[model samples]
Target: MSRHRQRQRERGQAAVEYAGVIALLLFVALAAIQLGVAAYAAQQAGTAARAGARAASMPDGDGQAGLAADAAVSSWLTPKTQSGSCGDQITVSVTIDIPQVLPIFDFGSARRSVTMPCD
Candidate 1:
């Protein structure tokens, strides 16, 4: 009877341990996913900024250059947050919104700046 009771107790112990391991695995997976998203967003922002700066570097009126830069960045970044300047040298700043996976925590926004000489 005593041995049987011990075996029954051990059965539930395995289940508890398994649940803990599974929970830990899930936490790690979520963290990895968040990191991947952040890296992707940052890369997109950098690409967008570079494209915008290149466009703005063209030899033309500042208004046209600005418009071109805005259009170039719009494909990858939100229009409301995209900013840049055009002159002897062109500079572009891009900010991208980070997707929210958790309600109580925020990963914040990703920003990138790029500069290029006018052609």
Candidate 2:
């Protein structure tokens, strides 16, 4: 009787341990997802900045260059403005929206800036 009671008590212990392991795995998975999203956003920002700088360097006009840059960037980005002297150098800036998964956590805007000489 004593041995049987001990075995019964130990039966639920496995379930409790399994639950803890499962919870830990879930937390790790969430962290990996968050990191991936952040890296993707950062890559997008860099691409947008480079595109914007190249556009601004064109000799034609700022309007077309800005538009082209915006198109090159990810849809999450809203092209702000391209400014600088005509013959000297031009600067292009793009603002990207960061998606928030957690209610308590807020990822701020991602911005990229690039400077290129006018062509």
Candidate 3:
């Protein structure tokens, strides 16, 4: 009877350890997914900035660089874009909110800028 009781206690201890390991692995997986989302947001910001700058630099292009930037990115990103001229160059900047996988954390925004010479 004592041997059987000892085995039952060991089984309970093993179950608790397994639970802890599974929880840790779950947290790591969620963090990895959040990181991927942040990276994708940053890449989108860069792409939008470059596209806006390129459009603004063209001689015949209409002054819709801001609109171009917004259109270049996914709708869910909600890119806030601005364009300005510095000397003979046009600069475009894009800011986008990074999507949060976990609601309790704020991952902040991803921003990017690009400059191109005016034509």
Question: What tens-digit string does per-residue lDDT give for candidate 2 at 1-119?
Answer: 69999898788898899999999998777777766666677677767778767876777766665676667766755655445655688777766666665444466767777778887
Off by over 4 Å in 1: 60-81, 102-105
Worst 10 residues of 1 by lDDT: 74-83
Models 1 onward score TM values of: 0.74, 0.76, 0.84
Candidate achieving higher TM-score, 1 or 2? 2
Q: Which stretches of candidate 2 lie over 4 Å from their true place?
A: 76-87, 103-105
lDDT of 3: 0.87
lDDT of 3 by residue, 14-78 (tens): 78899999999998899889999999999999999998888888886557677788889988888
| lDDT at 33, model 1 | 83
* Model 1 lDDT tens row, 86-108: 55676677777876555544778
lDDT of each: 0.67, 0.70, 0.87
Worst ten in a row by lDDT for model 3: 59-68
Candidate 3 similarity to native, TM-score: 0.84
- Candidate 3: where is the Cα deviation over 4 Å? 60-62, 85-87
